[model samples]
Target: MTELRGEALYWEAFERLKSGKAQIIDTNSPSFKFTKDNVAIEAGKKKGFVKQERYPDLCDSIENTENTRCSAASRDPENSDSIKLITSQKKKANARYSKLKAEHDLCLEKMMNLLRENFELRRELQELKKSSMQ
Candidate 1:
């Protein structure tokens, strides 16, 4: 078959993955993270099988496909630590947001208090002028 390029190649890979024909995997991929596994897997140190297929066929479809639907990414028992890490990251982000929100509320309160004081001072000065005129 003639080689696919650009959009065609992207779709080819996408359709292969979407239809369960092939998949995207980091292992043996050209990306920095997977490049090393090419050797390790070949050396039989890692227990993985290689297949000649389109993109994204390596990991279980559940791990990759669950996000496209309503269900959570189904993880193997060993991947619970990854889920924990994601939860911890969410907590850290929430704490930062709460701190910033509290600081903003305090600043807003101080600004409103200053505006009220300025208005009262102006009113008092106007009354003093009227008394002096009388």
Candidate 2:
């Protein structure tokens, strides 16, 4: 029996997790955030198996996967504060709306300035034509 190393080891761990063959250790609840140590343990290896310096890709993949899982969990009503999240989202939406409104006003002001310039140019052209006719 040969022991796995590097990418192969992390791949095996992820497979086990996906297949429900292994469970994350040391987590008291489902809401617990996974760490490198958890991945190591899940792979049936020591907590030191996941080294950031040596296995950066594995670590990055684990972090990305965990973030996705956490975000999904956050949307679950039992796992997060729904009212607080809604309030924060609303605040962000209002801030975006205010920014867009300011940009629209600035564009409108520029359009008005251009229209005034066009009017002045037309008035000057009319005066030139009258002088030339005289």
Candidate 3:
């Protein structure tokens, strides 16, 4: 699709909205809903939550998709190779998460220790001050 910037984009959107080619969802609208399923899948198909989300626009695009206009992933959403790619990526992601979790837990333990030490030092300082006054 042609990319429109600045006033062109605004005017195009305003015209489309005026002509009823698009829809605007208001807060009190009966169709207004928020769920994890509705979240954008920029993270790819590794997210099962996103797969269950019903997007009318996706179905429309898939049905009307042109080879020239379609993205690489859009070419074949149900391909076996795509599934293999997703599985491989998911495994790598899980490994990275485990590593990060270990590091986070270690850092948290260090923070807790430092806090306890600070409390102990403050208590000792108060006791020393009292002793000096006496």
Winner by TM-score: 2
TM-score of every prediction relative to native: 0.45, 0.47, 0.43
Q: Rank the candidates by TM-score, best first.
A: 2, 1, 3
Tens digits of per-residue lDDT, candidate 3, 9-82, equal 33343333324343332323323223222222221222333222344443343234323223543466564476
lDDT of each: 0.50, 0.76, 0.49
Candidate 1, overall lDDT?
0.50
- After superposition, candidate 3 runs with Cα above 4 Å error: 1-78
| TM-score, structure 3 vs. true | 0.43
| Best of the candidates, lDDT | 2
Q: For model 2, how does the per-residue alpha-carbon lDDT over 6-93 read when each residue is reduced to its tens digit?
A: 6687777765664556665535444345567777888777888788896787788778878987888777876567556767899999
Model 3, residue 45: C-alpha shift (Å): 24
